[model samples]
Target: MMRRGLLAEFPTGDALIAAVRALHQEGYSRFDAFTPYPLPAVQRLLGWRRSRINYIAAFFGLSFALGAYLLQWWTAARDYPVIVGSRPAYAAPAFVPITFEMCVLGTSLSVLAALFVIIGLPRLWHPVFAIPGFERATIDRFFLGVDESDPYLDRDRTTRALLDLGALRVSLLGEEAPPP
Candidate 1:
């Protein structure tokens, strides 16, 4: 199988953060870090931008609300005109409640769907999980994983750089076990 990536183990969160910073400076953008706790520094170094979920939510919410209002208006005015209490057939005020409810429903559902799709939810497995000792990432150890597809990735050089950055060990990650 093709190489997946390289996983480097760091003894401390600081070391992991430093390694990420150095790699970023060295023009490595396709890497990820794992730590027992959140590291704002690492996140910044990774250059993650704000999520687009809000835009998605707004788009879907407005679209649904408009559709609901149009449907209500069409039903009242054209589809099945109902003359009730001498009110106009396409009464905008009467559609307010359903339109607002549809807006809320669409916003919430879109946010949930966007979050799931962005994060690849319901994932049962990841290649990182196959790396021995990686479980420590949830407890104490911090890790930096460099993707093989990175333009700057040269296995030997990356391993050396990671080791120089105070990595305890660097392992090849793929479908098969790393070489001894």
Candidate 2:
């Protein structure tokens, strides 16, 4: 038998969040959400955690600055001390630009590297793509979905759950507005 998922859409963030919380209370854990713009309130309600990408990027950037400064100083002042064109071997001004650039470059590279390491980049496909009406997600729509894989999923029961949440209407994703 072909499996189906229930995708509930909402006109606003409040409605979507209310539905999400209600579903969570009903033990619906397997779901993914989409929104046209950020909703700080919903992020809190969903219990989303802070991403470590920023921390990792900052750390890498700091490390790069320190390493670049040390490498330049050590080579010019201590390893093979040589003053070029009457300039001070440890002149700080000359190092500033290169140090700043390296910091930015390293931070950007590592952030992208971390993204690939953490959330596989180039993810050409996802299971949710098989669910109908999901294409609206990129437009002016907000969606909270119950996957067919969810334990609580039964076509009738899921639809009933959506309706109970005061959904404008519940319908099979691509069925063009099912008889509610």
lDDT of 2 by residue, 1-180 (tens): 112467777666788888888888888776656788887767776667778799999999999999988988888877987788899888888888889999999999999999987877776655546556657667777777676777977889878777777665554543343323
Candidate 1 lowest-lDDT run of ten:
171-180
Instruction: List clashing residue pairs in candidate 1.
Output: none
What is the Cα-based TM-score of model 1? Answer: 0.63
Off by over 4 Å in 1: 1-3, 10-14, 26-29, 35-44, 47-53, 76-94, 112-124, 133-141, 151-157, 163-169, 175-180
Error of 1 at 138 (Å): 6.0
lDDT of 1 by residue, 64-128 (tens): 99999999989898899988899988788999999999999999999998898898897766677
Best by TM-score: 2
lDDT of 2 at 177: 38
RMSD to the true structure for each prediction, in A, is 4.9, 5.8
Assess the local accuracy of residue 90 in candidate 1 as a C-alpha lDDT between 0 and 100. Answer: 77
